[model samples]
Target: MKNKILLVLIAIAAPVFFSGCATDAHYVQTGDKQQIISAGKINSQDFATAANDASRNLLSMDPNPLDKVDRSPAFVVFSKIVNNTDQSVDQDLLTQKIGIALTQSGKAQIKIVDKLGEDYGNIDDFLNDKKTTRRPDFTLSGKIIQTVDRAGRTRRGTYSFQMSLNDPKNRAQVWMFEKEIVKQGTRDAVGF
Candidate 1:
């Protein structure tokens, strides 16, 4: 009778004990204070910060290349973004953010183009040669580079986000910007 009662008590208390130990899921805004940080890899917060900085600097240019275009909103194409980091990262995370900011600001329009500056339109349109694509005034390209340093158990990572705006007509670089983000933590310290 004692063993049976003990077993029943354990079964009831086990769930309550385990439930207290488990963490409940919650939603938080991007780049929140509670977001996880890693020393060896780029975080979402890092991408947001870099993209924000790039957009601000690009929009603040004195000459304002976007204004020099014949059209109200300049058409811009993304050429390529090279990733030199150790880990695989989607370049769209950075470009898409910048693109959204620029588009929302009404300064530039993003155009999808191939290497030859052909529009990536519908297959039927291409087959019929119904090319309504306008030549892009500017092309945007970038590269992400990562460097790491270690001292004992402490590890530090620095990521460089470099971008350039080029005048396709003149084939000259109109604007260039670089943002560096560094993160440091102990090897065993993984989460927030």
Candidate 2:
């Protein structure tokens, strides 16, 4: 009955071998410890952290510029945010978080001054048969810069998020903030 014992052992070992080779996937929260980290690129967690820090710093300004406006919710338009990083990045990842925070704070309203905004404004004006005029009191602009350093087999990357709130009318910077995120690991390491 050697063949019978062999079949039994094969059947028992097959499941164990297959299970060991399979990987189970699961959901993970953003910025979780299990998130993947890259030394040469900016990760989503980096964006979130930088945005949160920048938003907090902006909101914590003494004599908050947002409160100085005459309107209940000051109008703010987003200007161009220059990206000096080697990798292509979605700026909305940074601006949207800051926008949501400011909107929820009840201190500012984001106004889209682009062609799309104008098109919607025109459609509303045509439908309502009245022209409404408004101007942004402040402009939000910034830049993202990346710097990298390597020591033997280990690598490090730093991303700097610089932002400024400026009054368009008087040409003055009301508030400015910078947030830097650094990631370090060995060349083959994937997660931090």
Candidate 3:
């Protein structure tokens, strides 16, 4: 009877062992249709989502949607974005992607405020010097915050990306956007 029970246990365990060992190499689309999603880390899809949301929000709230294209794209200056997450994250992972999308869509152009000043001289010096001054029409700034909660063996995390486009001339926030990404799984879960 003991031998029969042992054989039954082995039979049930065999498939699990085999399945765990089997891995077929395959191709996956970047930032989409992946079985494994990592938590506690930023990924390409997150950037894409953030950029898409910002672009869509900008277009939706555009005061003059009809002349959006006709009007010269506004010059965007990068402002300080706070990182409130525990993990070290590259801010460019979020800003640069949004900038590129905005540039490519012909809606806006990114002006490096620091670089521009550095190239000319300095902010104070530029103001004192008699040079052609090009002011940035809009400024992009925001923050990213991460929150983690776990239930038993499963861990869930939410990352919030907030961005705004402010009209420096009028001191008004012309456009605002936010995206929250939630990922759930544990470290031992090979495929999230």
Q: Candidate 2: how large is its RMSD?
A: 6.9
Off by over 4 Å in 1: 1-22, 113-132, 188-192
Best TM-score among the predictions, by candidate number: 1
Tens digits of lDDT, candidate 2, 109-144: 986433323533533343353545456667788899
- Name the TM-score of candidate 2: 0.77
Off by over 4 Å in 3: 1-27, 64-71, 113-133, 188-192
lDDT of 1 by residue, 1-192 (tens): 999999999999999999986777888888767778889999888899999999999998878998899997988887668899998998788889999988999999996443333454533443344576766777888999999999998999999999999876667889999999988888523246
- Compose the digit string of candidate 3's lDDT tens values, residues 1-192: 999999999999999999998888988775555545677666667767877787667666647331343347866776657789887777777778777777887777776543434544544443454447555666678888899898997888898999877665555777777899888877623444
lDDT winner: 1
Spell out the clash pairs found in candidate 1. Answer: none
Alpha-carbon RMSD to native, per candidate: 7.1, 6.9, 4.5
Candidate 3, pairs of clashing residues: none
| Cα distance off (Å), candidate 2, residue 34 | 1.2
Which model is ahead, 2 or 3, in terms of lDDT?
2
